[model samples]
Target: MNDAHHRDADAPLRMTDAQHREMRNAQHRETQRAVSGFRGDIEGLRGLAVLLVLVFHAGVPAVSGGFVGVDVFFVISGFLITGLIVREVRTTGRLSLARFYARRARRLLPAAAVVLAAVAALTVAALPPIRWSGVAGDLAASALYAVNWRLADQAVDYMASEQASSPVQHFWSLAVEEQFYLVWPLVLLALVWWHRRTGWSLDRTLLAGLAIVALPSLVWSVSLTQVEPGRAYFVSTTRAWELAIGAALAIGAVRLSRLPRAAMVWAGWLGVFAIVVAALAYGSSTLFPGYAALLPTVGAALVIMAGLAGRGRNAAGTGGAAGYGRGVGRFLSVAPMRAVGALSYSLYLWHWPLLVAAEAAWGALSVVEGILVVSLSFVPAWLTYRLVESPVRRSGRLVAVPRRALLMGAACTAAGVAGAVVVHAAVPPPPQVTASAGSRPATQALAETSKRPTAKPPPQDEPTSITLDPLKAREDKGPIYRPQCHQDQPSAELQFCAYGDLGSDKVMVLAGDSHAAQWQPALAAIATRHGWRLETYTKSACGFFDVEVGVGEPAVPYPACTAWNAKLLQRLTGPDRPDLVVTSSDTNYQVVRGGSILDPQASRPAYVSGLRRSWQAVRAAGVPLVVIRNTPRVNIDVPDCLSAHPRDLAACAVPRERAMAMSTDDQIRAAEGLAGVDLVDLTDDVCPAPRCAPVIGTMIVWRDAHHITATYARSLAPRLDRAMAQAIGGRTSSTAE
Candidate 1:
């Protein structure tokens, strides 16, 4: 163990036990050869990779492929860590798991904890109460090095994906790296033990074992990227192969040392070109960490291998290429590249949160804003690298005592958790306001509301001060939510629930996305009054339009949504068709026609055409359809906006024109002239004129940017009920009353 620390790069192994000396000595020399062959160019690669990721995240154009930098990082980590483990095992004759993990913790935790604490403080100062829960959750996950899985779950979740990015979202890559650090040592230890017991070549044994691990992981990655790309992007199972690629190179370092100088030079430059091209050309449309990842990972491997070949002992054969080494290594070892590389880890951690905070405080970061934010991150990154990461990592006392290192890690984790708790506690809860029946009469509310009024409407006076709570607004979902009858975006199965009088013969079926689900409270109120059986079939982000939907930024086809729609349409037009099929959707999609995508404006015609098709199916089933126009979509999360700027509720109000522009105007136009389709627009009740206020009738108007609060939705029951009655021509029992 002592020899493991003090041995020179070219030193031969010192053996104590005579029986194992030859085997151990040979192994040690091989490790020394690999370590002695280190090059500064690798650190330059780190600088380049980190810069690409930082700029890409900062929204730099033409760097859409910058995300591939993470693949480069995975390869680097695998190579360095694998080399260290092999060296230690060769010298000490045993793997010290405790020392390995403790070293990793010491190297990574202190700076991370400081950054997490800072982010927490910043979040409390700038972000709204509604965002605290998510940020807190991310902080905890980051502390535990499980943020990758947490983010994977969130990526597939409809509500979570819509949320603003958390300051610590960048921790997911670190989490993946940390998880590998934990498991890889154990695997290496096992392989060493097997090699000794079976008398097999160490490199050959490791190569076979890693191949077993990497191949299956690569297969899973390829398939999942096609199936659930969002989750696959973060999950460790899909990313294990990239790390394996680097480990394989480390095992073959002995052979890599023999490449010619010219070959090394060409390969090194080609590797840099591959990474640069990937960063410049790739965009959000690319399915990554799959086959596409090979370009960057292979490029990174080539660079590392070339660097190794240039430094090996043989000027001709045993390994040595000073001219090739000087060409790449000298350039990379320059002051600026070396300095950026030294601060890369801390910079990667700090840059993302600052960008997120900047965006959250204002709106999207302009190119100039992004540039300034990236520049400012260097200050903290340098400070953290010097003040926190350096001192603790180099401390001999902590390095010698594995237990002490672990204790320090525990302390850092505790600090991160405490920071998260403090941030979470700062968020104010929703105000408790009991609805008073006499405050606003159900009958007179509609009479006072004018149709198509152009002036800014007054807020409802049901209980003005306690209109909505930011915390509760998120939880204030409809009846269909509790039982999960309203399926999430990823679910393909059709789920149905009866909310009203189940025994009643007069059935009303409600269907669409969460926007349609939001109206359930109001519809249920009407259903109970008239003893009508209300059947709800809703899916998140799955609108009723008979068109393909996209999931993320580049708009990948949502297979689950397509499957759900097919199943739902079959059920809706089957023998159990209701007396009236009521549908509403927050239409947020670009139209897909004959495999070509049309933008939001051009897609209106296609949206209307899809609606006509649905109307025809329902009409053919001998059922009347009442289409509820979707409510206004505010530009910001009303609850969050109100919470952040509580003293100025007026600031939370969006102009009615802007809000209406976000509505399903295309779908409404499509419904025109269709037989058996009755359009019931209640936009006036929800928005009521020139502007849409955050609060109505002492109830919060919106839960998020798009969905309305259940309390507010219930408040609109009287108006919605009236519209349904008029649209159905008083067909139900309660209409005449």
Candidate 2:
């Protein structure tokens, strides 16, 4: 392996055989040609794709679908790889599928393994202990190019935020491409052999591929987009058609030479515009690849088509319309774009996490700020390209002695797998057991009876029952219970949320996800206030999606949540409905809705359709739905803010305008329409005046980048008091009845 591939301290050089293998693997590395037709333009297009992805990710309002740059890259890869393999088949008569894949493994496995190892280490250090377990599992899945399945399993949780923002998220695209590389080559080889053996020429062989393989893939792409947009967006099987589109272009390049230079320019420009526009306009709502995705995919196809070929005579081979396509071809041929294209693999690998890390290191970077960080991220990419990517890729050592590179590649892959094992071993989750036939935990749980407890609301003596009436006179007993009772805070304000002295008369129901669990302290205060008890029915990601109360975690239903919900549902219908369902999830849960961010819609229809089913389950259980419209979903990450600003509250506050921007008045108003449901007025409660602070009354209310900190939920007692008291109905009068 060239001097660059030598193992560094982070990557220990163990076996000499492995090192020799690493060096030798370089020969099989298939190098992409420097802009074959209009090299400059393709480089420009690659830059355009990368830029679109960058701006889109940086919260640029315009480039919503810019992320599809990855798909664009996929298509480009397909075209390029197809051309290479077909050329080999034509020249050599027999295509070596093993050699093609080995080259791919050599090219991809090293950098990917290195990056995966880094991400794994960072994940273990940064992610919560509980999260490391899955992070570990994901690591292993990613190594095998099956991470898409892991993500799909997690996505079943309607409330799961696309925490795919994990350092490893980019790996999904790699996985898709890797999977495609594995199968497409063999399929082509088989076809090429059959046709050539029968004396067919290259043109006819390619046409057959276009007719049989590429065409079917394109058709499936459209169909998959409709039925399973999310899967279609991420899954390789669904995305293969896009690559095939490019592959077809490569196969037919010779035929496209007749196009005018002017037309080529227009087509190429239009392709750029399409990708740019799609990136800028697509947002959390676009159904993706369904029909909407056609914009960028076709735009990319046009670029490939523009470069397809040109008759070099009058227009050369660029055709009559080759104006700037040739010029674009020339411009992209410039040194910078080509260099970037040369190192595009490394640049793509390192850019995201580096930018993300920068964003994390110092709050969200502005447009200019993001640009600077992106510029800086290239340093590492350049260094790696110069040090690792270049030498190893060009080296013929691997071709001379195949075992060295093979073993080295295996070791690199093993490191990733081993890291995955470490994450798993360090923090193991419950043992995995397959779910019963075809029944998803969410689906089965959603279908189960809605449990409304018949138990009376927790006794009035409970602190969760104390009333807070802004309109009422002040009582010196200070609302009966103290906020921050969970921990010592000499000055922390105290307020009551639950009331009534219960001798098995009332039940204090805690609902929602981990946000609800954080209030164990506050809930305990109320339970302690009354001669009552505390019960647990917690689900980690069950964000009150009534039907799928607990989902996507274990194949087995969350028996605990169901058991408690049943009891709670009985009480509500019979006489017990939660004096208060102290739920804390934002009604607007976010999801990766097909390469775009999607927030829950608040319109009556959106709400009714999205939530009524769950609400019905709740109401049917005979309990009043004490709906807690989610706490302010702060775009300003809380932990990040804390680390950035310790004592100065000003730094931690989300600016007034921005805070107002996130508030969903429509959602709250809709919840208010439910007379039986007590809407906890949080819009006003969470934000006092100038702004909503990430930490209020010294309680770090906002948690992580998205959720509220558990410590912060304890401080909401005062805000919850009046509404909770009404729900509990005056049971919280004494500490001991």
Candidate 3:
């Protein structure tokens, strides 16, 4: 909704009767102009933007680039808000920040507050208990309009990345918009003040100010997206330029209006064409809000500029230029389009939470089911718009007094936050399960190979208790998961940690990506028991191989992984090479060959070759190598599954064959002819034979979908030790300890 035109309330006290009448007439004319100037085309654009986002989130394959719809919204917001501020400044010769912010709060906060509280209630009713605390945190962030920063931090966080998406994650865009609203007015006010002092035209000053803000943001967006795409996608800095584009268009609207009618009509259709093409062409792999965002943002600007040119009334007394009225503007001004546009904001707020809740209750939805769920959200969206948004926005009591509206906004914000706190408090704490006194250390049990039990079918009954609480299982990572030890995706720096008997002469090194890091607890236990020093060289998602690989969704080339792998190989083949090196990796890594990422199946041969090349280098240096076959991946969040099926834990188990099939035998193939290289297959222990249990023995097996819990890994120390001893041809004297 546009801001209401408010004249100075105290002006009449100082004015003569004749002057007061003149002032009232002028104010009435301005108000009438503002009301008549409402762009039906802009309303239709809002409808189109929300529709694109809805279909995109619903997983419609046809609108792969529908995400550009958000860019369109950003541009429209910039144009409308900037125009409001500039118009108020020009007419009154001053701006009231208090009134401006109060209007914004009244327009936005009520509907948002209603949605956040609804999400909290939905979390309690539909989502698994394990997800409550995380959703509560998300709710708190959304309530404060800081969820975008929260989501940005989580995007690059290894642990948080594995967690399910928050229902309020969609609030990230709202957070960005609110942040802009908070800062943009002050910026424009400062520029107007400067224009008055410097004797510069207001248009020139505003345009210069927009350029100053937008240029650097555009550069940062492009640069950051190349290196840190995950974080770049959510952060505010990368998105500010899009809003500035609209502000620039608004500032130049008068100049645009003087353009020929034919030119404006062509520009309008071209803008529509650009948006449709982007919606059809863009996909997940497209680096976003960077250079790619220019298409939609500029397109939105052109459309708005076209609307300005068409503002003149035709002979029929209908709005818009005669030529523009017959073109794209007519289609956008239809009754159905305007209705959708009117409800767009509320629809945007309601659709995502419903979709997320539905998916949480019933696995991933088919395209038809997703569309149905999104369709169902319209009921809530319309209700919220009719009952909450319209009522608060048009409240006469709040409109007359800005302070009252601000206070009401504060109360709504507090209510949303309080709801989150209550939900968080309602989550049950992790349960405690103590180990039996009779059990021997896993290292000791596996060392006595002859007495080791044969693999058996997974049990039909769920265990009454597990060693670690399933709710907190994702935090059960080994030392290698630490930020200082394992490098993140964007860095090529070589960082390693020392564990086990650090001063021992015999050195054992653990190497590879997170898959290799998952075995650190077992290896550390074995190293200490055998009096060997253990050093680890691991990176998140980076494999210890000779070939380059890809990371993130849609799989871009990971230069950091390649550089780190090269540095690691140099250390292994150098004069101070360890006595033995143990390596493992997730075989699903896509190979980056000839500047293109190969599909998983196509990448397999390249991975096998890379493994052999690296192993040969280690062997040529006279260092023995042991390859831990990649562990089984359950292909679902084990903790989430277990928490959802706590009473029937067996329901979370995956068939042994399916779980084992997750790993390719690339390591075994690589070690086939290499004399000093040995392969250890732990699939039998981790999965048993008939099925893979989410909880094996007393401990939860998998921390997430693929990685094993540190608690479970420690339990396998004895088996790892025995296997290492046999592979190396004999047990050392320290093994008997």
- Best by the TM-score measure: 3
Instruction: Give the clash count for each candidate.
Output: 4, 94, 2
Per-residue CA lDDT of model 2 for 232-340, tens digit only, reads 5666656677777778777766556556767886787688678777787776555556566668878888887766435323232332233343534555555666666
lDDT of 1 at 446: 38
Ranked candidates, highest TM-score first: 3, 1, 2
Per-residue lDDT for 1-737 in model 3, tens only?
A: 12322345345554677687678647543542443367778888888999999999899999999988888999999988887887778678789998999999999999999999999999999888888989999999999999999998888776677778899999999999999999999999999989989989788999999999999999999988776677888999999999998888777665555567778888888898888888989998887767888998888887877777734332212433332465577778787777888899999999999998998889888899889998888899999999999999999999999999999999989988998998999997665444345644332233234223554323322544443467768778977777688788778898889998988989989999889999999999888877889999998888889998888765668898889988999899998899889999988889988998888899989999999999999999999999999998888888888777665666777766687678767888878998898898887678763656777656788889999999888878877787877888764322431
Instruction: State each model's CA lDDT, in order.
Output: 0.79, 0.56, 0.82
Q: Which of the two candidates, 1 or 2, achieves a greater TM-score against the reference? A: 1
- Cα lDDT tens digits for candidate 1, 1-737: 66766675224333435537576667557546645454566777788889999889878897988999999999999988887787777667888889988999899999999999999998988787778988998998998889999999988877667677889989999999999998999899889889989988888889888998999999999888775788999999999999998898877776687678678877878888898899998887787767888899999998888776634464322221333454454455555776787789999999998998898787778988998999999999999999999999999999989999999999999999999898888777664444464555321243255465423234542334454567777678877787559898668998889977989998988989888999999898889888889989899778776777666655666778778888888888898778888899877677766665577777777677777887788888998988888888886867667767665556677777888888758667878788778888878778774567776545677888888888888877777787777878886543321
**Clash number for model 1?**
4
* Model 2 TM-score (2 dp): 0.63
C-alpha TM-scores of all predictions: 0.89, 0.63, 0.90
Q: lDDT order of candidates, best first?
A: 3, 1, 2
lDDT of 1 at 527: 90
